[model samples]
Target: MEAFWAAAVGIVWGLPLVILLAGAGVWFMLLSRAAPLRHAGHALAILSGRYERRDAPGEISHFRALSAALSGTIGMGNIAGVAIAIAMGGSGAVFWMWVAGALGMATKFFTCTLSCLYRKPDSQGVMQGGPMYYIEVGLGPRFRPLAMLFAACAMVGCLGVFQSNQLAGLMQAQWSVPAPLTGLLAMTAVGYVVLGGSVRVGRFAGLVVPLMCLLYLGGGLLVIADHAERVPAVLRAIVLGAFDVDAGIGGAAGLTVKEILVTGVRRAVFSNEAGLGTEALAHGAAQTDEPVREGLVAMLGPFIDTHLVCTMTALVILTSGVSPQAAGVVTTAQAFEASLPGLGAGLVSAIFAAFALTTMITYAYYSVKCAKYLFGERRGGAFVWIYLVLIPIAALWTPTTTVNIIDTAYALMVIPNMTATLLLAPRVLVAMRDYFARQEG
Candidate 1:
């Protein structure tokens, strides 16, 4: 199983997929005229209720949709995923991660706008939208096979296994709790929210995401402040390592510049989910008539997840003198412990608990949406039970196996999603021009 998973990840995440994802992001960035960066403040304004519409044709508010999406993206990836990138690819990997995050903003803007623009009503008449809906509606029924392909891959990709696996590992390491018990507790917590549907998920996300982010960011800031003198040196190492061909240390001697780029881009996509199309399921539910506004709001996700949160984790790991051989959540815990003494591991455990739990809940929503799309809304509840059961099973898997499974599934999802997004790019550009013109007028 391990060998199979390793081979699957290697093939799916190879150079061709990497180039497709990155090249699409660059194309979107250039086509949009860098609107994600240029109008970031405006995005925040939309998030803050500036253009809110109570009578809009959707289920949840913009803030709640963004929160639900962030809940999925901001969890273990920010904590353990960054550590994995640095562990496997060296500190220079963080530089490429930053590059991915920057271009990802544009990807989010275009994909999310299309999600909102082409929403369709499900069997029960709930407004449904995502990459699948947009592909069928915007690109025509001839492309529905591609849409089904995305939904099929998403059912497996957004399973929350990595989050559950890492959270279970943290519990055993920090408190010696058994993995089964942690998995059961996690499954129960996530099932409670996801069963209540998107409204419950949105409200829970809006309330929890800000608090968890503040707590984690506050802890990360303290660590950085305590080691203020080492910041410059760490930053230099990251930038230089990004381009260094023979800069590997110890067992990392095989880490070429290509490996660094692949690892960084791969981790960044996993962290922020820019091209994965999962977040569109959440953002597609936003209660607004303006698709462009939702796109602008959605673009902030990569900035927050990868640029701000992941960078903090990288700094903590790099400056703590931990060996690059240390991987995943354990390395992050060591960094926190070194910087904060007795409080580090415990605080991180708490933050990880919050992060992982929220992620599971949101991911369940994504899976249910995929199931509903494929099997109809009546069968959606069945998928929820299936998703809940998988959490415990996932907890039993090793971290390496869990990561490989998710990376392979996510890479498969990106293929159809990026292809559809590229084909429909002109529609998004037209919407952007009209939306901005109306705002100015």
Candidate 2:
């Protein structure tokens, strides 16, 4: 099974897909005139409620929507995923992750904008939006097939299997709990929150995501500060490793350029989900009339997830001088333990639980959205039960198998999503022009 997954992920995440993901991001960045970079301040303003509308067409506030999206993207991917990249691809992989995050900012802007622009009313008359809605409504019924394809893949892709599996592993490692027991506990916790649907998901996310990020970031900072003297050397190793030609190079524990780039981009996508169209489902529910405002707000996700959180995780691991080959969460725990001794590991375990739980809830919302798109509103509730059931099953799978399954599904979802986003680029560009012009005027 492991070998099969390795082969599947290898084929799915090959060079063409890498080029497509990265190239499309660069294209979107250029096409938007670097809107993500130039108008980042505007994005922050919108997130802070500057352009809020009490009667917008959507369900949740921009902050809540972003919180929901962040809850999904900013979890295990920032912690365990980064550790995996560093372990497999070496320290240089961190550099490429930064690159992916930079490009992902623009990618999210275009995709999330389109999600809002093309939202539709579900059978229940509730506003619904996502890659499926945008692909169908924005591109017309001619592309309904592609919309279905995306929705189908998303049902499987957004299951939080990776998060569940890893969280179970964390429990087993940290507290010596049996995986089955941990899985049951996790499922009950997740099922309780998610049964209430998106409104509850958004509210829960809005409350917990920021607090979790702060707690994790605060802990990470202490680790970095304790090893302040090694910071510059770690940074140097990352940069040098990213471009190092030798296959057995000295830095980051020996990773070539190709390995670095591949691992970095893969983990970055897993972390921020820039092109996978998962987050757009969350952002599509934002209570706003301005698609551009939501898009701008959405762009901050990659920055916060990868740039802030993942970077901290990388630094802690690198500075702690932990083995590059160490297990994902264990290496991170070691770094924290090195810094604060007894308290550090416990804090990380708590943060891990929070991160994993929030991710599961938000991902349930994404799966519910996909299920509704695929099988109508009434059938959507059925998917929640299915999702809860899968949590324990996912806990039984090996980490590598779980990662491979999710990565393959993510790669599949990205194809239709990126195709639709590229085709609809001109519309987003026009919207951006008009929106910015109005703001300037």
lDDT of candidates 1 onward, in order: 0.84, 0.84
TM-score of 1: 0.89
Backbone clashes under 3 angstroms, per model: 0, 0
Off by over 4 Å in 2: 1-6, 84-92, 236-263, 321-330, 396-407
List model 1 lDDT by residue over 60-137, tens digit each: 888899889988888665776787677788888898999999888999999899999999998777788899999899
- Candidate 2 per-residue C-alpha lDDT over 1-441 given as tens digits, one digit per residue, 9 for 90 to 100: 899988999998777777777888889988988976799999899999988988889889888999999987776546777877777777788889999998999999999999999999988787888999999999999999999999888887788788888888888888888989988998998888888777888889999999988988899888889879988887887887788733222234444577678888878866787888988999999888989888999999999999999998988887776543444333677778877888888888888788888988888888878988888878876888999998998888746777788778877999889999999999999999999999999
Instruction: Give, for candidate 2, the lowest lDDT window spanning 10 residues.
Output: 245-254
* Candidate 1 global Cα RMSD: 3.4
- Model 1, position 7, has a per-residue lDDT of 97
User: What's the residue-level lDDT of 168 in candidate 2?
Assistant: 86
